[model samples]
Target: MHNIKDLRKNLDYYKKKLLNRNYNLNIDEFVNLDKDNRNLISKKEKLEQEKKILSKSKNKANFEKSKKISEEISRLNKDQALNKKKLDFILHTLPNLALDDVPIGKDEKSNKLIKKFGKIRDFNFTPKSHVEISSNEIDFETSTKLSGSRFVVLKNKLALLERALINFMLDVHTIQYKYTEVSPPLIVNEDVMFGTGQLPKFEEDQFEIKFNNSDQRKFLIPTSEVVLTNLVRDSFTKKDDLPLRFVASTPCFRREAGSYGKDTKGMIRQHQFYKVELVSVVEPKNCLIELDRMLDCAKKILDILEIPYQIVLLSTGDMGFSAEKTYDIEVWIPSENKYREISSCSSCGTFQARRMGAKYKINNNNEFLGTLNGSGLAVGRLIVALLENNQNEDGSVTIPDALKKYMNNLDKI
Candidate 1:
């Protein structure tokens, strides 16, 4: 959410910034509505003043006049509220402005590759996709029968591997990186979702829940990032705790609304999947710095898994709704003969904080906090990369050294 005062004063500046994001702001509509709302506020204040003056007299005429003024004030209050609601609706739909140094473009095609790590392994024979390699263990047929498409059932060692991956990520983040581990609720209220920029706009992509006895809006979290970042919602943190880092491994559910016919053959895209999410809350000035640290934390997981990956700075148009700048880590998929996104680390600046009402005190003044979130790594996609990259000609998969302990010293699956 943007400060209305700032938007009112710097309309032209915001117009250009939003345009780069491919969002066309209705400047004229906003200006007219703002003016009307302010006018109503002024009128209401004058009527209240008149009522106060009238209250000084006990005369019948004055009483009647005061009652009339009170009614007028009530009417103006409603009008102002309705006007503000319309204005806020517009503000809520606008995407965060991109950081100055972010590349300006309309989509991912213009994204910039920042770094490449590890060597892509050379296989003597043709490598098979995860679906083909784990045909016996990963049962999509059973999952489809139970829950339709975009779901999977990993049996035998593959099931153990998924659990191991989640545990491995949580340990690395909490023990080595100093993030506080949290097990947050999978279902959240509407306001909680809105606080994280997942409501009102991206409603279609969410799996909303309904109840026969309650009116409260609820949803299955698309990622633990929604719950982890919102831990600071409607609250203030002490300066001593400048950066609050949190990690969670959870089952994420998404509608995949506009993603039909994409990555349908494998676990690349799914309605249900596990993810180790990382969220950090810090001072606004240190947001970018925290982002760099967060990116490294996520990259560390892939490094430990010995996966070859590259980092890309997303274009302004490709960044998430709440992020000012974003970095995506794409891991090499041997079967696809390409790199696919396994993690996306983003610096939301104070955009989410403003929406969440999350703040920190600085010299007696409360200021919006900076928030960042990233996939420490998507468990399912990581599994795909691990299996495809480590597959043997005989069909067994070699486990990476880092996960060997977690797998009870079993080096192969």
Candidate 2:
């Protein structure tokens, strides 16, 4: 949400920004409505002032006109509500400005790779895709029977390995990186989704359910990002607490609405998956720096896992709707012989805080804090990358040295 004052003060500037973001708001009408509301507020204030004056004076005629003035006030109050609704509708569609450093491009192909890490593992024997080799351990048929497509049942080694990966990432983030760990609710209200800029735009990508016997709706969180970022919802904190860091391991559910037939063969994409997510709330000045720190935290996970990966700065068109800038960590998959995104780190700036009513007392002055979120690692994809990158000659998967301790010292599966 943008500042209302911005709409009134420089409607022309905001109008252009809205158009740039492809918002379909009627700029003239929106400005006119706000002007009308401002006029009503002025009239209301004048009426109240007159009433106070009349009450003090012994002017009988002025007292007699008071009833008519009170009725006008009531009518104006009703009009105020309508105008407020119009203002809210316009503000809801307004988008955050793109970061100056964000590359201007149409799509994913234009994303700039900032750096690459690790070496692609070489395999002597025929390397099977994770989908084929893990077939015995993944009961996709049962998943289909129980639910539908884009779901899987990981059994035995795969299940254990996924759990180990989640724990491994969490330990690294909390024990090593100073991020406080949290286990937030998997279901959140609509406001929480909107706070993270997921609602009013990408509703189809989420699974929503109604609360029992209530009009309230709750959606299964598409990512821990939703829960972790919304933790500051409707909050005003001291500036000294400017940077609040949190991490959580959670099961994320997504509808994946547009991807009808893509990556259906394996765990490359799924309806539900475990992800260890990182979120930070900071002062405006620190947001970009924190974005780098958060990305490093994510890269550290892949580093420890010994996975070859590269960092790509997402092009404007490929960036998430809420994100001003995004950096994707793509791990090399030997089977595909290319890099695929394993995690995405993004700085939303103050875009989310404004929507969530999250602000801080900066220098003892009120200001909205900025928010950012990124996947420390998506457990399923990381597992897929590991299996594909570290496959042994005899069809076994070698565990990375860092995760071996968490896997009870088992080096391979």
Candidate 3:
């Protein structure tokens, strides 16, 4: 959520920034509504003052006048409520302003590839896609029978590989990187979802459920980031708690609402998948520092796995709704003959803090805290990259050295 005071203080400044994001919002409409709301409040207060004076007089005419003023006040309050609703609607829908360093563009094509790592593996035999390589292990037909499209069942070693990947990533993030491991609830209330910018605007992409006994609706988390990052919701932290980092491995669900026919063949796009997510909360001033540190932690997974990948700095228009800036780590997929996104590290620069009511106390000041989240590694896509890149001519996968212990020291699966 945006600070209404900031918008009201300098509407034009925000309007220009948002225009760069391809949103043509009319600040004039909001300004007018704000003016009208203030006018209504002023009118109501004036009438209330009159009522106070009239009640003290206690005369027949004053009493009659007070009754009429009460009616006007009631009508103005209703109007004020309507105007405030409209104002809030506009404010809530506005996306976060991109940082000045972000590349200005309309979409992903404009994203900058900051660095590329590892050499593309050379295979004497023709490389096969993960779908073709793991045909015996990943059962799409069974997944279809159990659920629907964009789902898959990994059996035998493939399932173990997926679990192994999750544990390995969590180990790297927790043991080496010092992120506290957390097992957060998968089902969250509406407020928790909203705190992570998954509600109000992106409800269509959420899987919502209703309980017969309660009015509150619950939704399955689209990522562990939603749950891990929200641990500090409605919290007042001391400066000693300035930097809090957490890691979790959880199942994520997404409706993929508008992405109808894309990546429909394999695990590239799935409704259900496992991910090892990392979240960091820090003082506002340390946000960027934490972002770089967090990015390194995510990149370390690809590094340890020895997967060839590139880090792309996302363009403003291509960034997520809540991210002020984002860096996508795209691992090389030989099947697609391109790099595919395996993780996105983003610094939300107090955007999510305002939404979640997370604040840090510095002396007497309570300032909006900074929050960052990234996929230490997305298990499904990681599996895809692992299978495709490490496939042997005999159709078995060679587990990375870093993950061998987690997979019972079985180097080949």
Candidate 4:
């Protein structure tokens, strides 16, 4: 959500920035609505003044004029009420402007790679996809029979690996990265979803719960980011509590509405997957700096897992709805012969803060706080990378040293 005052004060400044993102709000509508609202207020004020004079005068002859003025004020009030609704709708449609440093591009094709890590393995034997590597333990037919397409059931060691991932990520984030671990509700209300910029614009991608046809809309969270960040909604913190870091491991549910044909073959895209999400709330001034620190925490997962990956700055058009700037961490997949996004660390600035009504008080002045979220790592996709990269010729996977403790010190799975 943009500060309407900023848009009113510097329309061209924001108009120009939004252009690089291939988006433009209809400022003309805003101008007309603002004009009408101001005019109505002025007219109502003058009418009220006239009524005040008539009342003071106690003149019977002024009664008709006073009655006419009253009706006009009532009419203006109705129009103002309707105008406010429309203005709010328009305001909600506008997306966050990209940060000036974000690469200007039409899409992901133009993303800029900021850094790369580890070496792409040179496999002696043709590497199999994660689906093939875990074929015995991955029961696709049963998944389809029970839950339909875009779902898979992991059995035996494969299922165990998923559990190990959740525990390992939670331990790493809580102990190593110093993020407070939180267990949040998976089913959240509409306001909670809206606070994180997941509703209104992207409702189709959500799984709205219709339990007993309840009137209140509740959704299965698409990411733990929705829950972790909303922890501060409609709340205020002291200046000393400048930065709040939270991490949660949970099952994320998504409809994959717009992603119809992509990654349909494997767990790369699923109806349900587990993720360890990281979120931070900080003073607006530190948002950009915090983004880098947050990304490092996420990168530590790949470092611990010994997975080769690269960090890419998301182009303007590729950023999330609330994100002003984003860094996508794409892990190497030997079978796909390309890097695929396993996590996205983003700085949303005050975009989500305004929506959440999250604030901080400094020197007696309350201001919106900045919010940041990232996938510490998506467990399912990380599993894909692990199974494919660490596969032995005989069809077993060697556990990475970092996860071995969580996996009961077993060397291989």
Candidate 5:
């Protein structure tokens, strides 16, 4: 969310920025609504002052005048409240302004490649997809029968491999990177989702949970980022606790509402998957710096696994709703003959902080804290990368040296 005062003061500037993000600002509607709301407030204050003066005089005429003033104030209050609601709706719909340095573009085609790491393996035989490499253990047919498409049931070693990857990622982030690991609730209230900029906009993409005889709306978390980043919601932290880094490995649920026919095969896009999420809370001034560090932390996972990947700076329209700037770590998928996004590191600046009411106290002043979140790595996609990239002609998969210990010293699966 943006400061309403700032949006009012720099309406043109914000409109231009939002335009790059493909949002058309209805300036006239906002201006008129704001003007009317402020006018109503002014009228109400004037009536209250009159009623105060009338109350001092005990005459019947003064009493009637005060009664009329009270009714007028009541009416104005409702008008002001309604108008403010409309204004806030507009504010909530607006996406975060892109950082000035971010590339302006409509889509990923305009995204800039920042760097590439490791070498893409040269397969002597025509490489198959993860499905073909582990058709027996992947068990897509059974999973589809059990829970429909976009779901998988890994059997035996493949299941163990998935758990090992999650553990390996958590260890790297929590132990080496100093991120505090948390096991948060899988289901969260609506406000918690809104705190991370996932609600009131992307409602269709969420898997909402319905309850009998309950008014409270709940949802299965789309990512651990929702829970991890919201730890500072409606609270103030000390300056010494500036960067609160958290890591969590949890099952994520998404409806994939917008993606009707994309990545229908394998684990590329799933309704349920495990991810080791990384979130950090910091002072706004150091947000970009922290973003760079966070990006490195995520990239380190691929480095340890010796997986080939490339980093790209997402263009304005391609960035997430809450991110002012973003970097995507796309791992090479041998089957797809291309790189697919395995992690996305983003600096949300104070966008989420404002919505979350997350603040930090310094020098007796409270300022919104900056929030950043990224996939330390998506376990499912990493699994796909591993199975396809390390597959042998004999159909066995060679485990990376870093994960061998977690995989019970088994080099091949």
Candidate 6:
């Protein structure tokens, strides 16, 4: 969320930016409302102070005057509501500021590629798409009959392949990267969603449920980022816990709203999938290093699996709502004949902390902490990439060396 102060102090600058994002909020009205709110608070404070003095006197006339002041306070409280509504309207329009180095682009077409890796697949005979080759192993028709489109049920070796990928990622993150492994809830409250910048926006892309209490409701977490990042929500930790690294492998749910017919074939797009997520809470000065570390952790997964991939820096308009910068890892998919996003690493800066109120008391000083999160790897996509990249001419997948142990030393599945 953006601060109303920015809108009030730099109306002209934000006005131009707002046009770029297609947001409509009258700047003058917002500023006036904010100014009114300040005045109302001032008036309320003054009235309370005067009433305090009058109450000290404890005379009958003073009592009547205090009562009148109380009535005036009630009226001002009513006026404050209108001011608050206007203030909220403006705050909701505040755009997530792009990082200084983020490339200025209109959309994905303008995103810049930082690097590439490995070679695209070649076939002696006509190579089948993943959906074609894995047909005997995957039950998509039954999945659709049971659930709906964009769902898959992995059976036989395909199921083991997905499980092997998840285990490999979690082991690497916990043992090699020294991150604390956690099992977080798949369901979270609205405040947790807001803390991660999911609420007040992107609501339709989520799945919500009514809770035991009629007034309470919860959302199925769209990503472990919401659950992991909010662990320190509203917290003030010591500097020794400066760089808190967390990793979790969990099932994530998404509505895929508005993407009804896109990537409708297989696991490339799905309503539910498993992923090993990486999150870090670190000192402000150490955030960039943490981002690199996160990328390294994710890259290790691709490197170990020997899957061809590229690292691309997302453009300003392409970055997420909360991210200051983002690096998307697009794995080579032979079937699609193009790269597909398998993981995204981002530095959200203090955007999430500011919303969640997750902060730290720096050594002998008061300061808020910073937060960062990324996908160690999205497991289903990893399976898709692995199957497509390592497919044998005989229609079996050659297990990557790193996953051989997890797969019981089997060379091919």
Error of 5 at 201 (Å): 0.8
Q: Write the per-residue lDDT of candidate 3 for residues 1-413, one digit (tens) a residue.
A: 78988889988888888887887878779889889989988988998998999999979778888999889989999999999999878877888999999999999998999999999998898899998998989999999999989999899989899888888888888999999999999999999999989888899999997755788899999999999889999989888966999999999999999999799898999999999999999998888999999999999988988999999999988999899999999999998899999999999999999999999888898889999999998999999999999999998889889899989899898
lDDT of 4 at 243: 88
Better of 3 and 6 by TM-score: 3
Cα error, residue 261 of model 4, in Å, equals 1.3
**Ten residues in sequence with the least summed lDDT for candidate 5:** 56-65
Q: After superposition, how far is residue 368 of candidate 3 from its true place, in Å?
A: 0.8
By TM-score, rank the candidates, best first: 1, 5, 3, 6, 4, 2
Which pairs in model 5 have colliding backbones?
none
Candidate 3 error regions (>4 Å): 48-69
Ten contiguous residues minimizing lDDT sum, candidate 4: 85-94
lDDT of 1 by residue, 1-413 (tens): 88889988999999999998999999999999999989999999999988998898767788988998899899999999999999889999999999998999989998999989999999999999999999989999999999999999999999999999999999999999999999999999999999989988999999998845688988999999999999999999999987999999999999999989799998999999999999999999999999999999999998998989999999998999999999999999999999999999999988899999999999999999999999998999999999999999998899999999989889999
Q: Which parts of model 4 are misplaced by more than 4 Å?
A: 42-74, 212-214
Q: In model 3, what lDDT does residue 4 have?
A: 85
lDDT of 6 by residue, 145-252 (tens): 999887899998888888888888999999999999999999999999988888877899999987787666699999999999999998787788679999999999
Q: How much lDDT does each candidate structure score?
A: 0.94, 0.87, 0.91, 0.91, 0.94, 0.84
Best model number under TM-score: 1
TM-score of candidate 4 against the unseen true structure: 0.93
Predicted structure 5: clash tally: 0
lDDT of 5 by residue, 166-201 (tens): 999999998899999999999999999999999899
Candidate 2's C-alpha runs over 4 A off are: 7-26, 51-64
| Model 5 segments more than 4 A misplaced | 52-62
Q: What's the CA error at residue 103 for candidate 3, in Å?
A: 0.2
Clashes of each: 0, 0, 0, 0, 0, 0
How does residue 20 of candidate 2 score in lDDT? 45
- Indicate the residue-level lDDT of 121 in model 4: 83
